[model samples]
Target: MKRKVDNSYGIIPFYIPSEKIVEKSKGCYLYDSEGKQYTDFESGVWCANLGHSNDRIVKAMEAGIRQSIHHGYKFRNHPSEFLSQELVRITGLEKGSSVFLSSGSEAVNLAISMARNITRREKILKIHNSYLSAYGYGQITPGNNHIENVHFNDMQSLDETNFGEIAALVLETGGASIDMVRFPDYAFIQELVELSVANGCLVVADEVTTGMGRMGKWFGFQYYDFLPDIVVTGKALGNGYPVSAVTVSAKISESFGKNPFRHLQSHQNDPMGGVIGLEVIRTIGDENLLNRCLDTGHYFKERLLFLNAKFKQEIREVRGRGLMIALELDNSVNGELVSDLLFERGFVIGYKANTLRFLPPLVIEITEIDKLITNIGEILELLRQ
Candidate 1:
């Protein structure tokens, strides 16, 4: 007799998972237990930028595992040191310092903590529609006293705010969590940063989803004119590995030296995490994936726009940059149903309310994108009836 499988026996029901058991993954594709192949348009929760089980990243991780995964807080690792240097160099945080963590939420919280400690302020500010972190000061809530919200792309909101009491303005440029890939206005961000800085409030860029060439730039903050005081990176940073980083500017690092804010975690600077992160950065640079991401993203958006024009009654709008794209359905159309149909067709995407988000791997080919587009059009035509 064959044994019956119980996939969800002990798993917490935080979110419902798919029934298909993923057996293997490689370069923007997932294979099921039955050997069916599916394109991973969501990039495995927007983490696998270079794609799932990238050979280079896997080799780096294997090497790190052979040497050491963890050294605790007492001893230092060369991987962590080298990774920090690379992060500082890429972010243009001259003489800055970096610390690795296990998740985006932790990195975001650490950045907020640093800003509060450095500014000696009690409040954090964020865009009304932005999603910063899963917990801590970054998580916006109605009852949260320490966090305040300013409307995105609204100058009036900025004009009314008192930056004097704010510690940091946490900015997340693009993500599925915040109504799907909404980019902030250039002028609004510039003024917001200028006003916040003038009032002694630091700017913290939450690049957890928008970093690692997801936005066709090294970091989303680069899209704007100003440089941020602190940067929190995760998701694509380790290319599917659970590693996050908090990088502070030279000024913030200097403040830390004088003020001394102690923060310790078990995996704070694990060699494996450092090794994976460094490999991810190096691979993206060596492959010239940033420019490729730009070109591919433009092509994808154009195709999506063409679809929008074709199905005027189905697609409401197409938005986002780089690999982070969203296709919002019309009010009458059901996005979840559309997503399910696409999943059945061997393509996995993200759906929230009326938005269908696509965060494909940077290594995704134009042919793969065309396949997805064709599937979407066919699905839409079927749903129209």
Candidate 2:
């Protein structure tokens, strides 16, 4: 069989597939062209909270297609309205506003634009590793809006001087922003928020990875004590359908009316994207999967801890929130090697550098997690031997 192209991201043969092709996928499992099945843990880049080929999402999208497929940007569509309104209800931001886009990077880029545009400030602060969509959005306009990196927990670096000239601070709620080596403390995040507010700056939380119950809450910021001036939600918002959204406080949104910050593309708020995303959110609340994520997070964390305790040297630490987990290895085996071994055993996972990220579908059964633990334990033991 022929192939359309490679992923262009890597030499691991990119989207060519180790096998012929992924014939079909469902729930938490995927079948390749050879009838071989593998458990999906990556969630198609950490976005498939509702899992693969969800019927409700699929049907909702089909219904949207049955209606108007595309419409003007200014005129509101039902799906976009439903999504923005539903997100507003969920986040409870007091008339919070939403701007739609089709990707995490785009959503984040627009967010930075909004912050600079509204606050009329010229500096942006980010931690050591930032996944806040501020990346590659041009070089901060050369001191017009300079960037300072605090390296995650260097919150002690959050004094008035360092944050000076800063209009907003952007952060990712999950482990992606700072790498698996270190994550920030919630207290520090709230502190930053309070400080920024007092000093006349906005706070932006990039919840693309940690939102939608992947982290046991609608938004990871909910776990923290305070609110941000702007919040960016993507990834699971469209469940792998390339849709993203930025929600801002009612106060900041007012700036747009005076000088509209035009963002979004032709496909930004596709009817299909909105309807499917809406159904996915509804399914999450309806099934109370949020609660399941919390319970299962505890259970999964306990099991992982047992492994960490068992192999104290190789396992540096087990960290992350809810269904998003990272197994930090201090050993020389390497994360990519471990991931490859697991893939050979019919488990698909990806890693960030040496840190292995495990983001299984929210609907993943506890038994499946156990199986993963068992496989990982046996492999690590063999490697040590």
Candidate 3:
């Protein structure tokens, strides 16, 4: 596994580029070009729920490719049709329909577009710190008149908001963007939904990172009481493959019938994307990964809590739901250094500012978690010394 060429020469550096060239990934481990094994605790950007190179998903993809890979928007594919039905059923949408796309950004933007079209309004509401998409109206930008920000758990902000011209309220329960992992207050979410609906504004759940058993459920919105008019899912939906879906409730779907909404993309509703998404859903159900995620997530959180207790001065708080856990370190501690040390010890996790994020594959075993915990404890101890 030797590097044959400089990989970063022609590529745009989106974030800080990693020096290591990963040659292979299997299950929960990655093999670098130098043949070094590193545990992938972040699930390859929080997408590989079933693990890297899952046999079932790969096989299904192969089968689908043999049938049909890409069909233009003029014609629909069988895999997309079946996937839409399954998505509707799983999301508990009443007579819902789905549209598949390549990335979370597109799905989210499309969902917002649908909301605006149905309500015939321009304004979209989003939580202050929640990250919905990479671009378009979903992405928060200064001077963006179409978007409005409401503070999470702040009743004053919600009450002050004039929902008169609002089209939809986009909600992201898993706050991976702001502070690694933060769940909103249950009461606030309930009240927010009620207010949005009462004001004729649709509710959109941005479950890009929180969907497909990431939060120990089919969707993050399930943790709350209300159902979203539109549900957007990505990340774990494709098991590392590029696929996303926007599922709309019967009401929203029916609105499109009377008031047409046209969306066209090159890879929209591709059969391969549909097959991969379907297989990911089916595999999670057949293998019972949701319950497994809950069990492993509990055990993992408990171990992290033990470390937190042991190093109370260094660790700040442990929070998150299911496998989407986060360890907030003391302000004095350098989270980037801790993450770098973990990488040196053959573990790959995510760090932003003072938070260490963990989104491991659901198939990860207890022993692997134990290894990570042991390493984390040792790292914290060393930092203290």
What is each predicted model's overall lDDT from 0 to 1? 0.90, 0.77, 0.90
For each candidate, what TM-score against the reference? 0.97, 0.90, 0.97
Query: Candidate 2 — what's its lDDT?
Result: 0.77
* Model 2 per-residue lDDT tens digits across residues 203-284: 8887888888888888887877777878788889888778888887888778789867776588777677778778988999
Model 2 / residue 104 / CA error / Å: 1.0
Clashing pairs in 2: 122-145, 128-151
Mark the regions of model 1 whose C-alpha exceeds 4 Å error after superposition.
1-8
Local accuracy of candidate 1 as per-residue lDDT tens digits, 224-254:
9788998899989999899999998889988
RMSD of 3: 2.7
lDDT of 3 by residue, 1-385 (tens): 1223443578655566468789999999999999999999999989999999999998998898799998786787888889999999999997999999999999999998988888899999988889978899877678668888888789999889998889999999987867579898999998888889999999999999999999789999999978899999998889999999999899888888898979989999999998999899999999999999999999999999999989999999999699999999999998888888999899999888789999999999999999999999998888888
Candidate 3 or 2, higher TM-score: 3
> Residue 312 deviation, candidate 3, in Å?
0.7
